[model samples]
Target: MIRFENIDLAYQGNNVFSDFSLEIAQGEKVVLLGKSGLGKSSLFSLILGFVQPQNGKVFFNENRVDERIVWNVRQKVAFIDQEISIGDYSVSEWLTFVSGIKANHSLSFGGKRLKELMDFFELSRDILNKDISDLSGGEKQRVAIIVSVLLERDVFLLDEVTSALDENLKKKTAEFFVERKDWTVVSISHDPVWLKNPWVKVFDLEKKTWK
Candidate 1:
């Protein structure tokens, strides 16, 4: 569970969240709905312990979320940002390198699991050998989505991850998340089509009140 108790977050000189509060129960799929740069992703940073709130406490279960426990927090969360860079390697090499990261050393990599995921996402097997940099924006986004899933995180922090994908792929990705009961997904998206899922609980970020 993730809980924010009267949290206040600010950056530079602007106040994003002021005395805001909410709790994500054990396995809730919540969506933070707002235009770009409306403090949506910033909330994810707070939940992930990547950024500290100016005031109030962030808690994951019984433990307080802070910089000290961020690595541990990250172990259970996977983030797929809109602008992703898998670096200048072939898709297969990127997958291999990503799986080599300390956090993912225990997981199966670039093998049958990846092939299955790629198939589910409707990506071609040939993409594994293609240059990662040469992939289109939508393709890159899908690759990032696949990588996040490979980590087997219980929570997903998706920041416009499907912004570049076409209608069909977007629906597929949304459906994928809907099927995962263990997933506590907090997503930021401008695409209305993604909101058709029954379990998606939306938070209106543009609202004036912090409560």
Candidate 2:
């Protein structure tokens, strides 16, 4: 559902990507793999329209990604950055605030779903009453992931989401995403937990191509 055709990107005078191209079909789980400074995050930025390509084009569900279509793209995709900060609001307050947003108003993430996700992620129910800023790094990562899933977006852009998580939690998170047959996931991770799954397609930024 996402396609990048001969994309070229640069920062200042340095080139980050040159004639890079990729296509991800619906319900596919793709993991971006490479060392640091290989523009893995920039690929996500390009898809989200946070950064525009100097050449070529990006398309989401057949629509070209540009100023006019970027909003629509954002609505369908849920992005979780490597560093997550959701202000200092309590977990309950934060979730309530997100539910109040116009775009998310139609969706219901009642107590049942919340509890289910928390249980699956091995998070304590007491965390719901804790302030976001007071939570540990791993807790914050799980909370961010839970919030993203609650959005009910079919497409996910996960950037180093399991970086702060332990090995077991990391494996659980990767399995959760890879097992979803109806979701399109593009994850950038250096952890080996994501590599154990044979169904996930691997894209190496070092080679500038997919395997």
How does each model score on TM-score? 0.92, 0.96
Cα displacement (Å) at residue 69, model 1: 1.1
lDDT of 1 by residue, 1-211 (tens): 8888988888997988889888888778777787767788888888777789999998886579877777788888888876887578998888889888898899987678888999988899889889989999988988888988999888888998888888888888987886789888877876665576777877777883321
Best by TM-score: 2
Separately for all candidates shown, the number of backbone clashes (residues 3 or more apart, or on different chains) is: 0, 0
**Global fold similarity of model 2 (TM-score):** 0.96
Writing each residue's lDDT as its tens digit, candidate 2 over 1-211 gives 9999999999997898889889999999999999988898998899899999999999999999999999989889999998887887998889999899888998876678989999999998899899999999999999999999999999999999999999899999999999999999999996787766898999888986677
Off by over 4 Å in 1: 208-211
Cα-based lDDT at residue 160, candidate 2: 94
> Model 2 misses residue 49 by how many Å?
1.1
Model 1: how far residue 175 lies from native, Å: 0.8
What's model 1's lDDT at 206? 87
